[model samples]
Target: MIKYAVHILFLILVGICWTPAEAQFVNLQIRVEPELSAEVQQELDFGTQITNSGRSQIGLGDVNMGIFSIRAYYTQNVYLNLTFPDALIHSNPAIDQEIPMELSISYNNSGLNRPSESTPLPSEGGLVAIHENTTNLTSTSDIWKEMYIYVYGYIDIGNIPNGEYTGDIVLTVDYD
Candidate 1:
């Protein structure tokens, strides 16, 4: 038909104009823009800044959302490890207690400076559990969850008796 002939002609014209596929194009670019912030907790607004960085885009990567490190300097030389929260605190806006989540973090502290040097912490457990937390991390893209570094972090001595305490949080990023 006339339509078929016209389609063939168009293809021929395009082929004449474009070079072979292998050498046709150069400088293909992909990009990812990262934004990081943290959920404001009660009486505390601890947060993390996520930077996707320049000239980078991944199909996916695990991001530890929130602060990465927490350092508390005190007179008595108190110390605490601000661990990452485990699992996404999934909740429906319509429901309160009904939620779905499956996430956890565990590490071994060989007591580098605790107790006896010979005694390992014996897999003394740690958790990345959820809290009543929320953040400005509202995204319309699924790529972020897969390709972003989650900034999961928190402060220490969060549950202690009345005492004068001081600490400063430190968060860092590493790429492989």
Candidate 2:
């Protein structure tokens, strides 16, 4: 009975010494980031191939050759450059040879110029600017702005010999 009383007294002492403590709170903040970028792309194409078939004695002047087109994407601006290796060349079948002829280039549907009009291309491969981002240019029916290139062959029929003539118009496109 005395041991039991001692054990009870020890328990009472431990309970009296123990004390309750207050709890605290901690606040935290977090954040996240994302990537914002666009990929640039371009496409260039030529219209129908032009062939001036048979002809009689003609006068001297510029002859319309063909048309070209350019499509750019994912950019607010674009640039176009053209390089002509050689003008329209006339090949003499009898002699099996070719001669370079004087050629010039003009454009319609160019964003750099007035619409529905023609602008001559400079000889030094001038850079043509195109406004309006291509993000909205999704399809052919979409409000797509086309850059039309026109090829013209200058000829003096009186001074040159008659034969089959050929030429190439190269167009390069890029995001500005």
Candidate 3:
């Protein structure tokens, strides 16, 4: 027994140079953008007024001011919530008239569409932050960015009882 056949040829050369261990794989991705919008270009008309005993104003560079357009994500940061209507009802549901109001807001990203060179916004609405205007940068508009909102108010026509009057102005935006 030549040392048991050289220990069976060194266990068949260590089982032919053994090997058993392998696992390597990797792949991952992500891209989700599209959600942050507000568009009402204009609609807060305070026209036709006649019953003055007091406040019946409409000044915020009034052109029947009410123009909102905010489509963000170009470095997003926004929060505007305005839910007006203290009083102004009587679309003639038998005319149980009511009129007494006061609302106000303003904003402009300074891209200059001129909402009367807007600024003041705190009649209750707040936090509108988005600043990175590299001359209104555009590599095909850089993934959207536009801000402008203005809505004027005032109406305490003390002797109320006209024919038509309506209310409801709710503009809520998020992501602060």
Count of clashing pairs, candidate 3: 0
Summing lDDT over every window of 10 consecutive residues in candidate 2, give the lowest-scoring window: 34-43
Global lDDT scores for all candidate models: 0.27, 0.47, 0.76
Q: What is the lDDT of residue 40 in candidate 2?
A: 22
Residue 57 error for model 2, in Å? 13
lDDT of 3 by residue, 6-112 (tens): 99999998888777879998876788657577778778776777875677677777777788888776667787878977998988787776888888788887545
- Please report the TM-score between candidate 3 and the true structure: 0.36
| Candidate with the larger lDDT of 1 and 3 | 3
Cα shift from native, residue 97, model 2 (Å) = 6.6
Strongest candidate by lDDT: 3
| Ranking according to lDDT, highest score first | 3, 2, 1
Worst 10 residues of 1 by lDDT: 70-79
Which of candidates 1 and 3 is the stronger one according to TM-score? Answer: 3
TM-score of each: 0.18, 0.41, 0.36
What's the C-alpha lDDT at position 44 in model 3?
77
Candidate 2 regions exceeding 4 Å error are 1-64, 74-79, 85-100, 109-116, 132-144, 158-163, 174-176
